[model samples]
Target: MIPELAPAKACAAKVLIADDEPNIVVSLEFMMKREGFEVLVARDGRAALEAIRREHPRLVLLDATMPGMSGFDVCEAVRADADVRSTCIVMLTAKGRETDMARGVGAGADAYVTKPFSTRDLVQQVKDMLAKDTAARALATGSAGAGELPKDMPA
Candidate 1:
């Protein structure tokens, strides 16, 4: 008789949605949950930052304008903290101006996606970003295949 193999464990990736708008939060929460992500939410920037530090989510969908600290502030703080600096941040805001996008990137957000975004695109982007991050980490830890360099590295 053949021996049975145990199933591999799968850990769902955590995604934090930081937004003050109740409707937006509800939709995002539902979408993320449907996409198999473990969703965490914060209604304000302060709470968002607190959650980020405490929970260490794999990704953050940050709103630019919020009561208290502001998403830019939270992004900067996360980037400055070495322990959580690697956490991916995607600024999802109504502020669609080029200057605002620049500011988000300046503050260390991995991606800045304005509001009114396509949910399908957003989900794909998140998956791609997480995959890229995982690959980078694997390369940094020398677990990536022997002759391959991370995409960002010069040939």
Candidate 2:
């Protein structure tokens, strides 16, 4: 009989989404939950920071502009934190300017996505970031068990 490959282990990852826009947060949270991710929502940058500090999510999706702190500030703050410095950060904004993208990168974001993003694309990006983060953590811990996919959301 031919040898069979083992299935890859599913990893549970938590993601925090920070966006002032209610619609955006709702839509994203729904999609992320559907994809088996534990999600936390923050309506503003300051709240995002607090959540990150308290929850230490595996990934952060930050809106570029918010009522306070801004995405840049949140990214900076997270990066400066020793506890969660390695968390993956993706910036989402309506402005797609090169300078804006640069600013996000300079502020320590792992990815930048435009506001009018395709739901498919956003979900894919989230998966990619979480996978990358899991790999990195696995390397650091020297264990395959980095964290199961999160529980499914209610129908």
Candidate 3:
């Protein structure tokens, strides 16, 4: 009889929620945790940048108008820093104007989500962005087969 092998497990992805609004933070935390992410939280921009540098989360949900540095500032800083420049940033803010979106993108945000957004959609978007980012990184590093299971592994 063949022995049953345990399935391989991937590390849980880290996601940082950087927002000032308590309600939004709570909800985002809940949703991300439910989706099996290791969630981190920062209530202001300065703290957000600190966490990004220290923890190195795979993605950041940032707020534009925070108490100190501001999401744009944090994003720009992240892009300028070589260590964390590949970190994904998604701006979640009340500022929904065209210029605000443009500024967020210019500052290196991968996506911009406005206030009163649907949590379900946000979760889906996050998943898609993370997957795309991972694929891109794998390709850049010449690991295009990174996601493939080994030949000895059962399907």
Best by TM-score: 3
Residue-by-residue lDDT tens digits, candidate 2, 5-58: 996555557789999999999999999888888899999889999999999888
- lDDT per residue, candidate 1, 1-155, as tens digits? 99999954457788999999999899889988888888999999999999999999989999989999899999999999998999999999999999999999999999999889988889889888987887879868977786654443211
Better of 1 and 3 by lDDT: 3
lDDT of each: 0.89, 0.85, 0.90
TM-score of each: 0.88, 0.84, 0.89
lDDT of 1 at 135: 84
Instruction: Decide which is better by lDDT, 2 or 3.
Output: 3
Off by over 4 Å in 2: 1-11, 145-155
Q: Is candidate 1 or candidate 2 better by lDDT?
A: 1
Kindly provide the TM-score of model 3 when superposed on the true structure, using C-alpha atoms.
0.89
Candidate 2 deviates by what RMSD?
A: 6.3
Residue 22 lDDT in candidate 2: 91
Residue range 41-140, candidate 3, lDDT tens digits? 9999999999999999999999999998899999999999999999999999889899999999999999999999999999999888888787777678
Q: In model 2, what lDDT does residue 148 have?
A: 38
The order by descending lDDT is 3, 1, 2
